[model samples]
Target: MSASTSAPANSAPVAHNALPPPSTSSAARSSRIAPHSHIKGLGLSPEGFANLDTAGFIGQNNAREACGVVVDLVKSRKFSGRALLLAGAPGTGKTALALAISHELGAKVPFCPMVGSEVYSTEVKKTEVLAEVFRRAIGLRIKETKEVYEGEVTELTPSESENPLSGYGKTVSHVIVGLKTVKGTKQLRLDPSIYEAILKEKIVVGDVIYVEANTGAVKRVGRSDAYASSYDLESETYVPLPKGDVHKRKELVQDVTLGDLDAANARPQGGQDIMSVMGSLVKSGRTEVTDKLRREVNKVVKSYVDQGVAEVVPGVVFIDEVHMLDIECFTYLNALLESPMAPTVIFATNRGNALVRGTTDVISPHGIPVDLLDRCLIVKTDSYTREQVSKVVQLRANVEGLKFGDGVLDKLAGEGEKSSLRYALQLLTPASILASLAGRTQIDIDDISEMNELFLDAKTSASMISESGAAFGS
Candidate 1:
């Protein structure tokens, strides 16, 4: 038996276009770059107090000021031989200070960061690793002005003829390319190889491009902005037209590392053919750079610097957990610091008095030798106060797209004071999840209490384990 229910006779149907269409907008992205991604600068004001924006720093005023002084010294080219050492307890903002310094130094300056444990390698020697890092921290900015043709490509045509070697095929003899600039226009008859390069670059009419005067190299900048407005939506990159004549002199700038130069010189090309490329792909390992070759490269770099064709840029090398390096590496660093080409070095450690890694009878400050320590300007980061910890918790919550209810941040800071700052920071995500599960946008004290019941801090866990020695089947 089937029974059917009748629909309501007075119900009105909604029209397909009853409401205005939803507005189109770019999606707002939540930035979860890192725990400390919100840090933009040193957060220091002109009088050296905290700035109004805070700049991601809540405390550590002394350390930030010291780093500001270091930045000034670095910019003036007066910082050499002596390295900056940041010594503090774990969870203090040591690495954050280094990052702030790099940001202040400008984007063009190279900043090489590494961990001391990364120096250990089965296939590479330790000294070679150190030397490689030293070379990588140096940069060369080469600037040259050359005559070239650059503009939007108004027309592109290739003239082909019958191949002499193969009658069934045709080869491009020469390409007729027309370029239009703001000031003028020019027509060029380029070689067939340049045409091939143009094809390889996916260049076509309405794209802005440039050709090298001497090398005849074709480089496509982007699609001209004049053609960009024709499409309601596009995926191609667009650039404004150049502001000069089609045939004119242009300045070209290239920034490269000394390590890059060393690698280029270390590996000699097999050939330009496909077989040579396949052979290269089949045999792959780390390239070995020699001392003699490095010296030659340095001489060439010096010559270029003297000829006003290039300038040497002193960069920064930050080694975190630097106490992991042993006596030999420290000795090498002492000599390396005296070199004329050494980069600015910054060493960070969370250790106090400890045994040096490679030594049996030696125990020194921060696990470093006295001589090396003497060559360092030590900056110490202090532990955060309760207020600072609360501020830091708020900053972190903002970074992770979480909100706090009344008294939640203060409760978290108190927990941090009792246990540790890191442990307190670790609870924010889980607390946020608990809040989400409760169908609330703001994390409350009850969520924090639930997290505390689920997860124990290090001290609490250690105490519990000691109280029940045999429970773990030890």
Candidate 2:
């Protein structure tokens, strides 16, 4: 051994091997969350409209551009009267386009999504259900400047006292919380109510929290960044040390959907007891909110908007399979779109000239009334090309953490071209299962072929059903 750089005479050989490393195997990290869970944004540049494969989206630049325009209109408050219609074939990413718009707008903007048949609830009037969704799509951003004790928690000691009402357990009289900011640290003798809030929030010594002085509300910001590099176990969201004094006036922006206000006012909770909560839950079983109560809530919301206490943020209401909404609901929707408190609406459908639901004689384009269609800016999403389908399949494989054997992806893409993109993507998981059963880690062409034979695509299934004489149309 070398003289100066030799190992210590008393050093144990396996001292560095104290703990095992984190697992990074495919089985450990694999997830089949959703087809579009990887979709984050519209996959476009912030300034120029650059068509690039980003945010798990492959193509459809035109639809994305139109959605971007709608997003712009939503932000500028000019998308009230008009609506955006996503007209496309199935699996062409219409819903994904709408979702991308909401993502582009940010999390504060409320985006209410519903199927057309959801309005056909037995308990509520169709118009009432539609009105509730419209209200939910609109957000009220309330800004409040309140005195809050905000800092990284250095110490959390709950002082306990004997309970006078119950002999079973002691009650927390007050909580001694030592809060530290960059400026200075302060100890707070908070109320017992605030201690309950702290327990509810799961606040620990390393967590950053803020206690509202007036309402006695406690909010956990996140864990302090000082302990971020300490260990790796459960996921940790580390935040920087709070700025300014431990006790300061912080301006908090609270976002609430209009439906939330209506519900709160309609069935106001009297107390925090189990009986009261149960009563509220039971009363909430009635789906419909009365029109008179909604009007009163609207008046209060308008006053709040007028007084500058809260600003109205109109968001998107995406109705998928909009053709299922009947003529009456469509009429109500037309009136709702023109209302002063209306939010931007986006419709999605795949129909061409077809019978409008609830109409025996009248045939409208896309199964929607001509009047509503005229008010919409139709953005068409094209079917995926063979190359695009291949790319999408590859993307899905990567997302699902599956290894593709030689020529497997090309074979799948060929199948996609023959049948449909949706059909091709559906075989991926089954093929992986087959490969696993055959003692192979990667899915080969044989696995793909076996899956193709076992499962029928939509087209093949339809053909079989037609042959069975089940009254299916050609």
Which model scores highest in lDDT? Answer: 1
- For all predictions, the C-alpha RMSD in Å is 7.9, 10.2
Candidate with top TM-score is 1
Question: Candidate 2, 296: how far from true, in Å?
Answer: 2.8
Please write out the lDDT profile of model 1 over residues 1-474, one tens digit for every residue.
Answer: 000011134533322223422445666444455866887889887765556448888888888889988888888888888899999988898888888888888788788889998888887777788889989989999999988899999889999999999969899999999999888889999999999999999999999999998999888899998877777667899999988899889989999999989989998688899999988887757766899999999999999999999998888889999999989898998988998989889999999999999999999999999999999999999998888888888888887778988989999999988888999999998777665544466787877887888899999999998879877676
TM-score between candidate 1 and the true structure: 0.88
Which ten contiguous residues of candidate 2 have the minimum total lDDT? 1-10
What is residue 216's positional error in candidate 1, in angstroms?
Answer: 1.0
lDDT of each: 0.86, 0.84
Worst 10 residues of 1 by lDDT: 1-10
TM-score of each: 0.88, 0.81
- Tell me the spans in candidate 1 whose CA falls farther than 4 Å from its real position: 1-32, 47-53, 229-233, 271-279, 282-284, 470-474
